[model samples]
Target: MPSVEATGAKLYFEESGYGYPIIFIHEFASDMRGWDAQIGHFSRSYRCIAYNARGYPPSDVPEDPQSYGWELAVDDIAALMRHLDIEQAHLIGLSMGGYAALQFGLRYPERVGAIVAGSVGSGCHPAHRDAWLRETSVPSRIFVEHGMVTMAERMARGPARVQLKYKDRQRWREFILRLRQHSPQGMAKTMAHCQAARPSLHDLSHQLSDMAIPVLLAVGDEDTRCLETNLMLKSELPNAGLWICPNTGHAINLEEPAAFNAQVENFLGAVERGSWLRGFPATATIPSLVRSRGARRDHSLIQIDQETEGADVVRLHLR
Candidate 1:
């Protein structure tokens, strides 16, 4: 029941355990409950906080569409941190939340310890920008006309979500039930303004190229919409490491919680040990691996070999 006032709304957040904080942000189709698996695993060693974003129940839902935006989303994270008297915390966000985490790190570099961005960059590609905008509005209208039950069922079965349905039917059912409880009006406005109106990740390359915070960019191999954009993010962000889960989809955490949790713990461990290096060296060569046509299906992990000044090769493993 704990809550914090953030910008124009109040955000409901839950926390457990104690230590350096780790904040979890959910995707559009989920709420703070989506982070249950994370909180259970990480709370033993780290303070885990997950919050319901504005427009989700237990958080204030602003009626005006103008109240929802990418900037506001970024500010909400800051506001929560400030409200809790946290100087800095590791941020982990998924999909919509992932975009906010990246933007937050960019805007407030000094306040971030590290970032785990999962299943992001869906509508950010220029090639799919128009189609994304068109498709985004369809859900908004659906919510307004039919309500959460209809929208939740439809969205739960989306191509990017199929993996979860097949991998864990019970978990997928719970996710749909939670999604069905969201506010219809809040969802409608969020879909229209926040998701569809946000700027493309391609437009932020200049800023991402200079970011100094350690970032782990994670996405599912089957999440076709985000695959290319995540690759672009890895290339642009000097301090970013990428992870692509095999046979997975958009909800990587839910589909493969053990793998997702292990990868994150390792990243955080490296950061804590000061072993996480800065961006790739200026002379580092990133080969053109992606093909021009059709998706490639190589199970071998994407490895980047970087030769440091001491002639030691640092291998970056993207699994």
Candidate 2:
């Protein structure tokens, strides 16, 4: 039960094994246990560190929503790394955590060795941002009042749970119940932070191409929410590789942890060994929606280049 005080919040974190550091940050409303599938496997080969976001389990929550801005969350992570004397470490973040990690990397590239930005995008696409705000904000009321149970039930029914892998109905029910036990206020605060988040990432995108550290941008192919933006990010990131998990949605890591873990291992290995250096997005292409004010609503159908196996591609049609 390791803990650190940062940004007026006490963060709860866990550390396992001993090797090159790898930190896992959970998405909004999720505690550190959301990364259960990763901690065990990676700990055997590398240092695995997972932590609860501020106001989530094992952490403090402020009554004021403004206390939990993205900037503060980013500072919390930076402080955590510094407190641990970790000058550089590999980062794995999901959903909101992914957004935080992307921001962290952009602001402090030298502090990160590599990054696995999972189930998230670079925020360059307006549609992606709108979709995220709408989807996450839609559940703000239920989350703030009833906690994660309602949210988990809806998530369990999403495309990510296609062909359920649960051993039995009882287990699935229990999992959902556990998620329900998550803090309501914590999630509401997170949702508010997301609503206030800025959509532009030009500065980050510019810094991305210059970063020497390797990066992997992964998301579910069925995730219409972030697909457009993820692909946009892949085109701008300097040394990033993209992976789209098939039969999944926004919760790619949770739905296909095995595939997600394998891709992460490969990305980390390539980064450390410096074996693969081929850069994606040979050139940056601006989406017409942002370029032309009077562009038609339906014009180009942008298809995600799903060169990877078992990965789904989401197409965006803009006029």
Candidate 3:
């Protein structure tokens, strides 16, 4: 069991293969084990490192509520890399981890090769800030009152996560089992401070616009909470490319590992080949995709109308 000291806590991590480092950060409901599929696929060609965030088992969980925060999460990633003697690496993070990775890129641009931000931007839109804060406390209180099993069950049934339950019941069961093992106090503090009190991504427009590192913004079509925020990120970040998985949900890496893995591999390939551009081409335009009756419901093909110059129209079919 390899571990690294990160601020006030120690983080447990696992690594495989050897090449350019690729760090994996799990979501709020998951731990490093959530990245098993990704590690299996990427480790063959690249060094894959996944770590359990603070508050998760195998990682130190500070007792004080004040010890958990968004900034600390961002700094923890840096500390882990520094501890491992890694200069720069590609970062892939989901949900909470994604937010940290984005902040890390902003704070340390010179230390990042590329970034994959998946299913992020929850509670980040300005219009939803108030509601998000209020709703976030509900989960925190639940964890404190009913414990991890009760909280895990409720969280597993979230609207954006129901897709996983239906698509793969076995994996969904495993997810719940693992989630139930998390520290209730750690979760409560994380939800209260990190999720409820952290600043929204909308507040970082200036930094996002000036980002120089290549970034891939991925979210499921059914992840309604992140749709608007991800769109905003695509518009703000000059180096970002957006990909919306059809009929997928928040835990996309688990729901559709093949597609997720393929997309990430392609992006990494482009980066390695120096073919990944800084921004969308001047002539490239995203046209509205209006579905025809009887059209395929499982997948969507985006039609880009490149005839118009500087056209940035974005519309998608939503169920």
Which predicted model would earn the best lDDT?
Answer: 1
**Candidate 1 worst ten-residue window by lDDT:** 286-295
**Greater-TM-score candidate between 1 and 2:** 1
Question: Per-prediction TM-score, please?
Answer: 0.89, 0.79, 0.87
Give model 2 RMSD, 1 decimal: 9.7
Put down candidate 3 lDDT per residue, 1-319, tens digits, no spaces.
Answer: 7999988899999999899999999999999999999999999999899999889888988998777999999999899899889999999999999999999999999999999999999999888888998898898988989999998998899999989999999999999999999999889988988878778899998889888788899999999999999999998887788999999999999999999999999998998898777533332222233236354545444433332345676434333
Native-referenced Cα lDDT, model 2: 0.73
lDDT of 3: 0.89
Better by TM-score, candidate 3 or 2: 3
Q: How many pairs of residues in model 1 come into backbone collision?
A: 1
User: Model 3: how far is 317 from its true place, Å?
Assistant: 35
Question: Considering TM-score, where higher is better, how would the candidates rank from best to worst?
Answer: 1, 3, 2
List CA RMSD, all candidates.
8.9, 9.7, 10.4
Query: What's the CA RMSD of model 1 in angstroms?
Result: 8.9
Q: By how many angstroms RMSD does model 3 differ from the true structure? A: 10.4
Task: Give the backbone clash total of model 3.
Answer: 0
* Candidate that would win on TM-score: 1
